[model samples]
Target: MRSSVLALLFFACASQAGVIIGGTRFVFAENKKSISVTLKNRSAQTWLISSKISSGSAWPGNDGAVRPVIPFSATPPLFALHGNSENIIRLVGSGAELAQDRETLFMLSIAAIPSGKAPPGSVQMAVRSNLKLFYRPADLPGDPARAYQALGWQRTARGLTVENNTPYFVTLFKLSINGEAIDNPGVVAPFSKRQTPWCQASSRCQLSWQSLNDYGRVMPAVVTSVYTTSQGVSSRVITSASPSR
Candidate 1:
C-alpha cells in the first residue's frame, strides 16, 4: 500500500510535467475555418485531456455561468493519451456575428485528468493550463501592430491620461512615467481612456511601455515620446505582450 501511494505520487507529478502546450497564446482571425493546437503527453501514464472555452477577462469557474460570446468549439473534448503521444485540438468558430469594430477575447482551458483511482487514502488532482484566444474581426479599423501610435498620453495635474484613439486594444505589460513604475499593468479598451496617478503634480516626465508580442510573450520595453517635436501627439505606436483588440 505504501508503494502504491508512492507510485501514484510519482506518476502524478511526472504526468503534469510531461504535458506540452504549443503556444503561449492563440489567435483565431476572421475568414479562417479553424486553428489547431497540439498537446503532447511525454509521461509513462495515460492522461484524459479535456477542454472548454470562456469569454471576457474572466475564466470559467466551477460554476457554468460564463458563456462564450464569440462561439468556438474544441474537438476531441475528452481523449486518452498514452505514454509519449500527442493530440491535436481544433478550435472552430461558430459563424455567429460579433462586433466588427473591435476584437473579442476568450480563454481556453486544457486539463489533464489522470486515469485510475488514487491509492486508497491518497488524493488525486488534475493539472490544468490556460491560454488566451483572440478573435480578430475582418473589418477591424486599424492594424493591431500599430495600436500604440493612436494612444494619446497627456500629463495631468495628478498623474497621466492615456486615451485610445483607434479601434484596437492596447494591453500594457509595464508602464512607467518619469521613471516611476505603475503598480499593475492594464488594458486600454478600444477607443477608451485610462488615467494613472504616478505623481502628485505634472512635470516634464517621459513615458515608456512594455507590451505583448504576437506570441503572447512580453516584448522589450520601448520609450515613447508622448508628444511629437511639434508638441502634438504622434500617430505611430509599438507592440506588447498580450492579445490585442
Candidate 2:
C-alpha cells in the first residue's frame, strides 16, 4: 500500500524559491490612496499567491482566535502567478483615522504555495514573506533619514533605555555594547521607548547601533558612550561617520 502521509514545510523568505518581491518594505503615504507592489516569479512552476494585511499581533503562533479586521485591503488577494511572470498587487486604504502626528505600522504578508503536486513521499513547501507596512502622515516634523541619530539613551536600573521621540519608527540592528554583540536588538516605535538589559546601570560602556532606512538599507553605525553620574545618566556620541558603501 502506498503511504498517504504528506509533509509540509514553511519558509520565511521566498527569494530562495524563485519568487522576488520588489521591495523589502513598503510605505503608504497619507496623501496617496493606494500603493502597488510587484511580484515576479522566476521558477518554472506556477504558484498560488495570496496576500493579506494584518496587525501582526498573532504571527508565529498557532492560536485559533479570530483576528479583528484591519482598515486596509489588498486587491486580487488570491491569484495564480504563472512561471516567469510578473504581477502587481495593489494595497488600498480606507482612510482610517490613524495617528496624525506619528506613523502607524502594519504588516503585509504574501504567501506562495506550489500549484503542482509534490512527488510521492516528498514534502511540499510553502513560502511566506512578511513585510513591514508603514502609514506615514503627510507632514511629519522631522527628517526620517536623520531620526536615528536623535534617539535618546539612558542608563536605567534595569538596563539601557532607548527613547524615540520622532514620528517615525526606528529599527535598530547590528547593536553592540562595549564590543560585545547584543542579540535581537529590536525596533523602537514612534514616540515610544524600549528598554534592553544589555548594559549595567553604574558602568560606563561604548554602545554602537545601526538603523534601517525606509528602503530597508542599513545605515552607518553610530557609536556612543553611556555613562552614569551622581545626577543621573547620560549619553555622548563618539562617532557617526558613514563608511564607503
Candidate 3:
C-alpha cells in the first residue's frame, strides 16, 4: 500500500500553522557570532520542527538534488516543539568567506510537521515557512537606511530602468507611474540594475515608489520626475520623502 502526504507552504509573514516566527526578515551581522530567532507554537498539539538555511535563490518547491551548499547552519535543526511553548533557533555562521563589500542574501526555512498520527488513508498536512536572511559585513560604507535615496531611475522606450549603486539590497514595492499602479515592482539587488516594461513615451513622467527597511518596515514614499533629456532619460526627485501609510 502507498501512503500520501499533503504539504502547505507559506512565507513567514503569512503562515497560519500556529507557528509564529518572530521577524519577517533576519539580519546576521559579521561582527556577531550568531543570532537567535524565537519560534512560538500556539496550537494545542505537538509538532516536529525542522529548520535549515539555504542560498537565496533556492525555493521551497525545488528538488534537493540541485541545492547549493549552505554556508550557515541552524542549531537544534530538529526538535519536538510542545504546544503553547516557545523555542529559540540560533543561526550560526561557518566562518565561510562571503562578499566583504556587499551584503549576501540567504533563506531560512522552517517546517512544522504534525506529530500526532492521522487516521488511516487520511491526508497529512505539513506547513513550511521561508524567511529572508541577510548577512551584512562590518565596516561597510554609507548608511543602509539612506541607500534607497541613491537609486537612479530612467524612463526607457520599453519601460523604466532602476539602478542601485549601493552595496545594500533595496526591496521596492507600491510602485506607480503617472498615478497608475505597476504590478510586481520587485526588488533591486545590491550594485545592480533592473528594468521593468511599464513606461510610455512621455516628455516627463511621475514615478512613485516605496522600499522596505532592514527591519521589514515600509519606508516613506518617494516621488520623482523622469525627464527625457536631449542626451538620454534622467530623473530628479520632486519630493524626497513622505509619511508612510
Candidate 4:
C-alpha cells in the first residue's frame, strides 16, 4: 500500500514550458551504501525512461590533470525507491511499470504521485547533475493524458573528490543522505524557510541543525562523491590550518 503523504513541498514550475526533474543537491553516503532520485509523469502522453551514468569528461584540477566524474564509479551505482510502506524499496520501471534506457542502472525510487496540474512554479529539489529519466506517464493508472504531461525527471548529480591534502592514504571519502520520501531514497528530512535550532549533551558541546535549524536536505540537499586512487600509501589524516582560517 502507498501513503498519500506529501514529502517535501518542492516542485518545478513550467511557466511557458520545460522538462520536469527531481533529486537533491546533497546525498549522504552512510558507510557508503547507495543513492536514489525521484520523478513525476507530467506529459500529455506516457513516456519511457532511458539512462547513461557515465564517467563524463574532465578538465584542469589542482595538480593539472583529468579527474574522475563523481569521485565514484559512474557505472551502475545502486538504485532503489520507497513505497507505500516505510522503507518499502521498489526497483525502477517495475510494478505499475515505467520504461527506461538499456545501459543505465535504474533507481529503485517508484512513481507514486501524479499531479494533474503541476502549477507554473511547482517547486522541486535537485539543481545539479545532468537530466536522466526516472518515470513515464503510464505509471499513473487511470490519470488522463488530457490535463497532464508525462514528467520524466532524470537526476544526474555532479561531484569531485579531494585527496584530503594527503600525498598518501588515498584520502578518499563519500557522503550522501536520503531525502524525505518525495523523491530521494535516502533521507526523509523536510524543508522549512524558517530557522530552527537544536543541541544535546550541552549547548556548547555538540549539535546539528539546518538553516531552519539543521541544514536540512530541502534545506538544499547536496551529495559528495569521493574516491582514492589507491596507487600509493594508505591511511591519511588531516588537521591543518594551512589555508589559515
Top candidate, metric TM-score = 2
- Which candidate gets the maximum lDDT versus the true structure? 2
Error of 4 at 129 (Å): 6.0
Off by over 4 Å in 4: 1-19, 24-30, 56-245
Give the true-structure RMSD of model 2.
4.8
User: Model 4 over residues 1-245: C-alpha lDDT tens digits?
Assistant: 11112214332322112223354222222223333444443434222233333221211111222222232222223222122212212222223221221111112222223334443544323222342211222222322111011111111122211221111111011212122221121111111011112111111211111111111122211232112224522222221111101
- Deviation (Å) of 169 in candidate 1: 2.9
Which 10 consecutive positions of candidate 4 have the poorest summed lDDT?
A: 164-173
Candidate 3: segments with Cα more than 4 A from true spot = 1-14, 58-69, 117-124, 200-205, 229-232, 243-245
Candidate 1 segments exceeding 4 Å error = 1-16, 59-68, 118-123, 139-141, 155-160, 176-184, 195-207, 224-245
Which pairs in model 1 have colliding backbones? 148-237, 149-236, 149-237, 211-240, 211-241, 212-240, 212-241, 212-242, 213-240
User: Which one wins by TM-score: 2 or 3?
Assistant: 2
lDDT of 1 by residue, 22-57 (tens): 886788888898999998887777888999887746
**Which candidate order results from sorting by TM-score in descending order?**
2, 3, 1, 4
- If ranked by lDDT, best first, what sequence of candidates would result? 2, 3, 1, 4
Report lDDT (Cα) of residue 38, candidate 1.
Answer: 94
Model 3 alpha-carbon miss at residue 233, Å:
3.5
In TM-score terms, candidate 2 sits at 0.84
TM-score of each: 0.69, 0.84, 0.79, 0.23
Residue 17 displacement (Å), model 4: 5.1
lDDT of 2 by residue, 1-245 (tens): 13323442323223475678899789999999899999999878788999999874432211222343576899899999999999999999997777789876778999888887776676667788888788889989988877877887888888888888999877677988988897766567778777667687448868888877888888888888888766774655566546425
Query: Per-model C-alpha lDDT, please?
Result: 0.69, 0.77, 0.76, 0.22
